[model samples]
Target: MPRVLHTAQALVDVILEIDELPPRGGNANARSERWYAGGAVTTLIAAARTGAEAVHGGAHGTGPHGDLIREALARDGVILSDEIRPDVDTGYCTVLLEPSAERTFLTVYGAERQITAESLATLAPQPGDLVCISGYSLFEPTRDPLLEFLETLPEGVDVVLDPGDPFADFPRELQRRVLARTTVWTSNADEARALTDLDDLEDTPEAIRRRLAPGAAVVVRDGDRGCLVFHHGRGTQIPAFPQKAVDTNGAGDTHTGVMLAERALGADWESAATRANAAAGIAVTRHGTESAPTRAEVDEFLA
Candidate 1:
């Protein structure tokens, strides 16, 4: 089976549950608080749970936050690197979850951001591996190193680009460079619209497809409405399996991970996407960043 390799950061997520978000000048009290390994970890856990050999190639620090990340990855069977950043602790994102399951985030940079091409090369990614990249890594200090590392990837290695909410904020040159190397483009509906600069959401997928290299694929995830998948010059709509969402923080990551895992296991694009939709459906119905379902759970849901 093809492996799913991650080049994205895996940070500790601090989740605070609140009745609602505070206004710009106001303060809101959290009803509860918890911490978990998140960021790229969510996707990796999802893939690992879905029977893919998942590897986290990103950097982790030396403190409590890093310890939490390593423990979670190990618990989920995702392979983690032994190298650690001794000088600084791992960073975290403050996640505010509303009663409606909406989430907002504020992040702090740490050792994970201090990446280098030389360090990443240790992963030794080979042909037929699916390497996951996120728009968040396009920032300074890590950006150049990641781009440089991507340039050296061997043929047959698939680059999976998951442009986060800041897709439109990235420099045009950086965007073009990453997209040029990306073989699989997966993102949410708003991010897809931002990428294509289109007012019509219906046309965003095709526009994104045209922007990629020949034979590249695109998946635009629309909440509840399901996902739109474009491959080989054709588009298919995979419907969502509705579920009552309690926490949606990692739903998108769950979808991405399950989809890639299915692909790595020799499933067709449509079949993979359908399972992904089902996985995400199950993910949202639960709490925490590690809420992704296992292969058996996904199969049962689909059945």
Candidate 2:
């Protein structure tokens, strides 16, 4: 019986403008726009929607953005145990999209970077709880505290590490420290390559499982191609369901969150991975991170 806790950056994302981006340099014209809640908040939302008792622990500032984050989480049934710091501005990111649908992001970390060891300690995990730590929260000042908190967890609590792109930003030694204790690790192809230092990303999931924690499961997500799951000395690749992707922003988070929920509920690794892939496929067919589908939607997709 693993109670779930989610920790990471929580931010507002504004889709600045959609334009024709030249492969080389020059920009084009503004077309469409939208905004959404981002980071582990999105993942926590997904987890809660799937019937998991999820609590979000992260830093936000007292402002409109912070309100949006809190309101959005509440709407999804996630408990907010972490407080918003006084007067600080919540973080935001501006996304630039090209005609090819490729995206470039300009982010302001804002209050997310202000998370301290004390803040992490406040959300300490009890026995049989699972702590989901995000990669974006593991760089610089937050890194030490995040690691310290992970180390302090009571025995028997599971730790799931979703080292987003920030996995590359960490020093190898620091990354090793986190992975050593992680019961599960999730990332995409590029992230897998960077973290494992392997050029052949197709082999990364197996390599990472072998080298890091032989018993730990590894999930390597490949956009459009599908996702691969490595566990128990076996590998399974699940194909991505066909869908017209409107935005792929939170697909990975959705996949990871759903996978965790299914596993927590006693689903087998293959079944959980398949369910996760279907959930993420549904996520991409919609706009924004919070648009991730409900458990019913995933069941429908699976059916």
Candidate 3:
């Protein structure tokens, strides 16, 4: 079976439940606070729960934060590549959750951003594997090494690119290089629009497809309205199972992870996307960054 390999950062998420965003000069009080393993960990955990063999190939620190990330990954059966950085601690993201279930973030980088060709060599991606990457990895220190490693992927390996909220801000040249190797492009509707520069939401998927490698697939996820899955000159809308969302931090990652897991498990794009939609629906109804549903839970929800 093809493994779901992640080449992205996993950070500790310090979540604060607050009433609303504070003014620039003001501060808001939090009703509660919690923490969880986030970032790439969300995707890997979702993939692992969906029965895919998940592996994390990013650098981690040799401190408390890294220990937390490692524990969460291990709990979910995700294999961690042996690339622990010495002395420094892993990074963290401070997430503010409002009553609306919307979230704002402030991140602090650490050892995870120090990826290199030597560290990435531990991943040793094999042909037929689905390697997942996030847009965050395109920043400075980490970008060059990751790009270099990507160029050496074995034939038949599938690169799954999840363009996060900041994807539009990445360098144009960097975007081109990554898209040239991306076999699967998964992101939200707004991101799809940004990538294709299309006003019509319906046209962005096809336009985005043109930007990727030939025979690439596109998945445009729209909250409540479901998602668009385009591949092989065909496009289909996979309906979403909407739920009352509480914390939507990891919803998109859950969708992408489940989609890749299903694909690795031999499901067609459409079927995999349908299951992914169900998983994301369940994820939003829960709390925290690791809210993705297990395979049995997803199956029950679909049934």
Candidate 4:
């Protein structure tokens, strides 16, 4: 089995359920809790749960939050060998969940922003490994390191780029560079629009895939509308299973992790996306990112 290497931000997420979002300076009654997972770590956990040998390449801190991150990853069977700064604290984010299951996030960069190119080079991923790069790590400090790492990837290695929300204004050069090396690119509808600058948000998956890397497989997720997958010059739109949505925090991460796991298990692109859509459909029906469904749940959902 190919090892899945994930290079991105890992943080401690503080989730809050609120009756209503505060209007600008206005305050509201918001119920909040904390979770010890974010971004790449969250995806790595999902991937490991699916029987993948997952390794996390990122930075954390020596603080309590950092310890929590390590414990959580260790429990999930994720190999963590990246550096952690003693002075800096682990990154954190605040998730505000509304009644409609819509969520808004305010994040703070901590030691995760300190992941350097030199540190990433130590991973030494060989050909056939799957490298997962999160878009949130494309900011100022981590951008150069990520670019350097991507450029040095060996041939035959499959690269999966999931640029999450922070990369809306990512530079064209970096975007092109990353996309050029990407074998699979996954993004939500808003992210697809931001990356492609498409006027019609509801364009076909084939059209969106064309706008992206010409030869790479693309998966554009349309929330409850389902996900459209384009690969091998073919397009398939998989409808999302209707379920009572609780929170959509890590649904995209679940989809990406499951797709990569399927690919590693020798499934074709279409079949992988089919399984991924099912996994994510089951994910959003629950609250919190870490509450993603198990492999049995996914299999049952597909059945």
**TM-score, every prediction:** 0.98, 0.92, 0.98, 0.93
Arrange candidates by TM-score, highest first: which order?
A: 3, 1, 4, 2
The 10 consecutive residues of candidate 2 with the worst lDDT sum are 15-24
**Mind giving the per-residue lDDT tens digits that candidate 3 earns over 1-303?**
999999999899999999999999998999999989999999999999999999999989999999999999999899988668898999999999998998899999998888887777688888889999888888788889989999989888999999887888787888899999999999998899887788887798889899899889999999999999999988899899999999999999999999999999999999999999999999998899899899999989988
The residue-level lDDT of candidate 3 at 163 comes to 88
When 1 and 2 are scored with lDDT, the better candidate is 1
Those runs of model 4 whose alpha carbons end farther than 4 Å from true positions after fitting are 166-168, 199-214
TM-score of 2: 0.92
After aligning candidate 2 to the native by TM-score, how far in Å is the CA of 117 from where it should be?
2.3
Give the winner by TM-score: 1 or 4: 1
Q: lDDT: which candidate is best? A: 3
Between candidates 2 and 3, the TM-score winner:
3
Error of 4 at 88 (Å): 2.3
Tell me how many clashing residue pairs each candidate has: 0, 0, 0, 1
C-alpha lDDT (0 to 100) for residue 3 of candidate 1: 91
Error of 1 at 5 (Å): 0.6
